[model samples]
Target: MTQPAFVAPGVVTAFCPKPTSHTGVVVMVAAKGDGVVVLDSGMAEPMPDALGPALELLGATTADVRAVLSTHGHRDHTGGSRALRDASGALTYFSADDEGLAGFAPDVPVTDGDVISSGDLRFEVVTTPGHTAGSVCFYEPTLKLLVAGDGVQGVGSARKLPVYYESGTRYRASLRKLLALEIDTLVVGHPLAWRGANTHVFTGAQCHELLEDSFAAAEAIRAAVAAVGPHPTPHRAALAVLATSPIFDHFDPGDPVEEDTEATLDSELRDLAGTAVR
Candidate 1:
């Protein structure tokens, strides 16, 4: 576990459990008055107490956690929610669209613009459906901080390609939506890289730059899939798409991009067949 880094007047963050692992979560804590909120709990089993460091830094305990917010339903992000909630008796907020994917029912189903308040910290939910149908980002406009989880993946450190199991178009759109926000500090679930730099945190202009690169990387994959036609297997298609993009030049080819390639191609093929039938 890494030490909790002070993000703002009331916010602090730490990459819980294995900081370098893509499967680990970035735990963020915000407090004001007597209430504290935790965002993105790590996996439950291996490191159920992943938020300990951040909580300690805040000089609080599980009892102070009034709400636990999940950026998405993925286990890495939500698996630890049960443990935390059990300890803190906190309300868990998740998106309704992702109820099917989550292991446990949420205390509250959040919408696109729901404002969650804890003392002076007010986090506005920004529903970004692409990484997953229910993926959401928390934006603290007053602090210009955005806890994005996996919502803005810019070619993550573990893989050469960005992965969005849902619609690539929607993923790109979500990135664009995030770009419109006034973000100075951006924290993500993984140590995603752009060009040659890898980090889970982005500040000031780096936030915009990271979002742009992520958007462009997704577009490059979309275009590459279209150009490669539909004859190749998903794996082969991924390789072809990779060969055409210089953004992946330094990284090793991995399975993550293949998943996205398959999803993107399948969507396009379905569209084409629909057009033909029409």
Candidate 2:
């Protein structure tokens, strides 16, 4: 039962109880009053059992929170959703595409452009399915704030690119969509590879700069895919690019470069499990 870290005036970032899970969601309080809303509930059994302690730390309660706005259906993101809803009497909403991964169905299956509001806080949902089929980001235009789910990833607070997930093409498009938005501060769901137990934050000019670099990486990945003739093994293509391109400023063939490209290589490579690539 750890309290979320204060990010700004009205926002706080919370974490899952487990060590493996870094970030769970962002909490937004009413601009002027007592209303509270959660971005995503961390993955916890019995729904949001840990949320009570977190809310306690924030000096709020399930009664104050009116809704749970989920960014995607990843277990880490949606695991505590059902419990949170039941406890807070909050309406839970997530993208339709992530039904399977989310395990439980949300009260509402929201799509792009949907609006979620609680008291004076308003968030516009932007669906960008790349990290997962139903991945999304929330934009508070008035605040110029972004609650970016797994759709974006990087090594530090300054993200130069979106982490590689399931689909390279879809991931590319999703990142581009996010970068196009006007944002003053960016809050992601989890810490980057280089950041441990620290909430990732990027603001002002740095937001645009890092996103631009990420976009460049996506563009380069697309070009590689095209050159490989459609269905090339993603790893091979990435390795080829790493060897020849400047996607990464430095790559040592002699050492394990896993940390440097954690976004692109970690889960994508490990998920291969025991499959043979003949």
Candidate 3:
């Protein structure tokens, strides 16, 4: 399918073939005046059919793409990097801390507090390194939007935390950083925007609360794992604790747990990384 011309100012244009059981692929298109900044190229191999169509929505051909900014080095987020760069001659930007994950060096090595601009739109680089060593969120103060890669998601109050982190503690700290910002819209990586309704702009206090909740969940999972003796069942045990946590309780009932049982846990672990009993 042909991609669409850009729609909505400061809106991220998402593209993916089929939504996965747990996540989805999204490509954020940041309008820089008449130019465009493409954040994340979805999936590496067997490119999703929606990619072309999604780009087309913005009247962007691969050649028109000027820059590719990555949230981190995950395959799903960086999968299309090579293709997009090769096709568009666009420079790719990433945190200097994530040079190894890019599978190539970044042209623009982003640092915390650095401001990136395309046109009238500018994003302040907020380093959030919990989900990955180099994970970062782009805050458009003018837009009041937080482009939080994998640092946050709306999975459920009780869903299992994402794996693939270089430092869980760092990730938690990053969450706190995100919360400190005045944000009403959270444009996440795997999911679309979380806004509207009763979702109020997050204050420093609320951000701190979310970080505390995340830390508590992590601690609960750690305690469960320690008690379970490095077995597969620890995941389920952790999930149970997470489900009961106050954070999870904030959401409505019937939220999905991607890996709810031992069988699914093993599968998810394999998919995320080689089997490890963490």
**Candidate 1 accuracy as TM-score:** 0.88
Once superposed on the true structure, which residue ranges of model 1 sit more than 4 Å away at CA? 18-33, 46-48, 254-278
How well is each residue in 53-113 modelled by candidate 2, as lDDT tens digits? 5566567877777778788887777777777777768788888788898887888889989
Instruction: Please give, for residues 1-278, the per-residue lDDT of candidate 1 as tens digits.
Output: 36777877777886666544543445555454357888888777754466777777888877788888989998778887888888878899989788777777789999999999877788999999888899999998888989998898886555545555477777889999999999989988876656666667789999998888888777766666666665646556655666658866645655455554566556545544565589
lDDT of each: 0.75, 0.64, 0.57
Clashes of each: 0, 2, 15
Off-target runs (Cα >4 Å) in candidate 3 are 1-8, 18-21, 24-27, 30-34, 46-49, 154-164, 192-236, 246-278
Could you give the C-alpha RMSD of every candidate to the true structure, in order shown? 2.7, 6.2, 6.7
Instruction: Report the CA-based lDDT of candidate 1 relative to the real structure.
Output: 0.75
Quick one: best lDDT, which candidate?
1
Q: Which scores higher on lDDT, 1 or 2?
A: 1
> Candidate 2: which pairs clash?
160-214, 161-214
TM-scores of all predicted structures:
0.88, 0.74, 0.69
Better of 1 and 3 by TM-score: 1
